[model samples]
Target: MRNVSRCGVVMLSVILSAGLASPAAAKEPSSEPEHVGVLDAAVESLTGDVYAEPSRWRPLSLGTLFTEGWDQAWASPTRGSGGAPRQGWIGAANGVFYRLGLAAYSYAHDVGDNGDEHAGTLTLYTPFSRRFELRHDIPFVVNNKGSGNSYHTNVGDFSIAPRVILSESQDFTQSFG
Candidate 1:
């Protein structure tokens, strides 16, 4: 189409002009590793602090809380199960998606009278190819006697499920093995 041709030409010209106007990148990287990093180190030496830090970062010391910028690191509270594993179900279907995954989740016994039963399971999904996938589940389970007398913790059984994907789509994916 004429319009598509014109758009392509315009894009090509813009890209070529941008390349010509800008300085060429260095063949060798800087000894300092990074430019902005060097500037940050300079500023930190002169001011004893940085203008800002990444989110979830905590201050190094309370004495310098307000004086020194919060540059130290702190792990996020919601990163994992948040101390207590989540009790829920999750599912996904489609294309290449994530080739591998690691997840931690918990389950509870719902059947007849049983002491509080909880299990923390680490589920790993490994895809060997677009059509083949393998899954492994390792669990650490525990049961606390309602009698207020004892508790048990043990390494639960492991499982493996090999799947062969026949078709995959946004709404549907069929697999069997």
Candidate 2:
């Protein structure tokens, strides 16, 4: 019990002194609005459910390609039975997390307004350390559509990466269950 009290006192003193000594901490509240304003604008412009929609609105047969920045990118093209083809694209660059990106695809046969679909993505990223990093501008939303009762369409994905790597590395893998 005595040891616990001592530890508590030490922690409290350290926290108080650190706060008092930090200029950034003292000035932080005033600048918080700027960050909030920027985030509001971003949230307003990029709207919708990112997962419910396909990345591409047009077919790959139409020769549509998405172009963006040096941060990130995602593209997926797929074909299945009794449905149209699907394509997706996602990407991001500049600003907070350095760069982040994402892309995926799904195809349905029949229903109502749903059919085949695909999506691509690009992500820009920034790292805080070798074992941790941040990602932003997550999903740009490449394409989305269907012939039946499909309700998938949205854009703008933001994320953070503890560790970043490329497809060449085994850090990323997928499994179906």
Candidate 3:
């Protein structure tokens, strides 16, 4: 623990010194067109694409929370069969991509003169393609009964799902997995 604390302090000091030394190293602002409205500005900032077209704009889904790219339909000149755009799977941004996410949760309970219990979970989401995604969870538990104390930890379940887009229009999109 002492070594870990020393390492953390050293890393923080380095970072702070580097930032302070580069106070004037900021990039020059470019002459780009300003967004039209509040919503447009917010979307542009979040997507990191100031030139994204409004016609191809889509709402931010679970998948797009990590990355953004060009729509598959516009990637090629030819449309899908029947001249309709190829709708990607649910949570997709209309192209092949992958994303990884980590999240943590904790719960605690206590009862008078009885015992105390605590639980924690760590979840991971790995989306490997436009159509398939995987999810896994790991959990641990602790309990204190009066004077005696016990701790337990274990792995949790995992699942995979393949998604498909059923129908999509300018205003609505439906998908299933």
Candidate 4:
């Protein structure tokens, strides 16, 4: 579990920094403006004990990952990249439950290309009650340079996720991602 989280952090760093190669903005004598950091939130649940001890838990999770690059850009020679903080989140709900959310925040300087990056997403799911299930997630990205920084973003891929029940126990659940 520790290794997986570390890998996720590394991958996110690479993606955010790739944007740092662009031209730097003209130097301004005034104080640099500050922008608000991104915030992400999410919620979820499993049929049985997804993270339960006896059953060993697993589930196919689908959600947007956020990245930020601001803290890194400031040290650049050309202001080649610099921005504000960033964040992200993932969550789900069904007829049985409501308002469940799960979320994560970007590290201070994880923004990839030398600019601060921020993002958020919303999703809608249908019970499909039984075993098979379907879900859709709409994701958004926001990268800010500062108070008046330029913006770069995308709605991200519209994907279809199909979930199957592999195993379920009274206190645990196991599924594949």
Best by TM-score: 1
Candidate 4, superposed: residue stretches over 4 Å from native: 1-113, 144-150
What is the TM-score (0 to 1) of candidate 3? 0.32
Q: Which scores better on lDDT, 3 or 4?
A: 3
Candidate 1 vs 2: which has more TM-score: 1
Score each candidate by Cα lDDT: 0.44, 0.35, 0.42, 0.35
Whole-model lDDT, candidate 3? 0.42
TM-scores of the candidates are: 0.41, 0.24, 0.32, 0.34
Model 3, runs deviating above 4 Å: 1-98, 111-114, 140-177
Quote model 4's TM-score.
0.34
RMSD for all candidates, in order, please: 18.9, 20.7, 20.7, 27.0
- Writing each residue's lDDT as its tens digit, candidate 4 over 1-177 gives 999999999999887776553333333223321222211111112222222231121121222111221111111011112432111133422212111233333333545555666666555442232233455565654444554556556555766565433443223333333
Task: Rank by lDDT, highest first.
Answer: 1, 3, 2, 4
lDDT of 3 at 72: 25
C-alpha lDDT of residue 34 in model 3: 34
Candidate 3 weakest ten by summed lDDT: 69-78
User: How would the candidate models be sorted by TM-score, starting from the highest?
Assistant: 1, 4, 3, 2
Q: What is residue 62's positional error in candidate 4, in angstroms?
A: 23
Residue-level lDDT of model 3, residues 79-157, one tens digit each, is: 3336665334543343422233444555556656455555555544443322233444455433345344544344444
List ranges where model 2 is wrong by over 4 Å.
1-113, 145-152, 164-177
